[model samples]
Target: MGIVKAAMAEEESKRQTAVEILMKVGFLDHCEHHEEIIFTVGGDEEVTGAYKYGNANWTAYQGSFKDRKDMTDHIKQESENSDYANDGCEICRSMFEKD
Candidate 1:
């Protein structure tokens, strides 16, 4: 079991490094599943990007932005097109319905 433990430790180390890099780039929320990490960029209030890290690399899984304006435009468009009834949690659906 020593070899298995060592491999697990190495993977944990890699995950920590990836988390550090993501945090530096403004990704504050993350979910880990096996070898993959999914990140929500620019905080929970407004996610400017969605990224994934695995196999020692980072990928912009959702969309890429050229600048702050581009990011803002994308967020605005997404908000306008969002179907909260179908997409969001119960609380979010209630909040959107109340708006």
Candidate 2:
């Protein structure tokens, strides 16, 4: 991979590692938003991904986010920035248009 791709991958790895850290700290088990988190890496729209899982589905959570809100909002912001209007998600361009 090129330097940029390598860097991106490394960043993604770091992001995931932060999440693992959260796992070790019991954030996923104790945080108020533990059950619902937006999982993403790289902050790249093309290859970036977002997924949500409930607290019951996970055992641990850890990270370096500003706070629980930041942790929960990252994926929502990413999905919104990507302009994805899926009903399964929280927001969409269509919703904005409808308002």
Candidate 3:
């Protein structure tokens, strides 16, 4: 393949890997919006909110996970000191309540 084609292919591979990691970490539901695949946390759109994974913003989210293990570890760390109720984030409260 040409240089540009090879580079595009590699980026696409990384994007697919990121999607798999997110889904394995409980972000199973996703939707396409404005050329981006927005994955909802905990499979709920209204509760846990969503993360945009696409060409434009992939770099930001991609760095957070080297693999599925890393992605899950990040979630565990975030939940360790999470203050859903006291923080006044209704979505967070609802998400925790569902657990």
Candidate 4:
């Protein structure tokens, strides 16, 4: 594979691992929005996990069960952060924005 394709595959692998961890910890549902795949654990609209892609890098933020709300809030805030938004890659944007 080409270097860029390889990198994307690696990033996807990282995101899949994060999803498994979050699901194991009770994050039951997930949806793609902008540059993030947001996972929810329970009744709250808060996030239990976030898989973020920007600048050709992927970042996984997982919330602890005991402090899930805070983590979710942080994820939400980070998603809207100017730095992240400005650095987002077009490929990542196209992949996630379809839904």
lDDT (Cα, tens digit) per residue for candidate 3, span 1-99: 999998787656654554554454555334332223333445333223223332234455556446544444444333332332132344455767999
Report the lDDT tens digits of candidate 2 across residue range 1-99: 999998787656545544543333323222233334333223333222223331222233323344444444543443343333222224333465789
Please give, for residues 1-99, the per-residue lDDT of candidate 4 as tens digits.
999998787655544554444344443333433425443433222232342221112233332222344444434444343432233355566877996
**Which ten residues in a row are the worst by lDDT in model 4?**
51-60
Ranking by lDDT: 3, 4, 1, 2
Predicted structure 3: lDDT:
0.44
Worst 10-residue lDDT window, candidate 3? 78-87
True-structure lDDT of candidate 1? 0.40
Clash counts for the predictions, in order = 0, 7, 0, 0
TM-score of 3: 0.34
RMSD over all Cα atoms, model 2: 13.0
Compute each candidate's TM-score over C-alphas: 0.32, 0.31, 0.34, 0.34
Give the better candidate number (1 or 4) by TM-score.
4
* lDDT values, one for every candidate: 0.40, 0.39, 0.44, 0.41
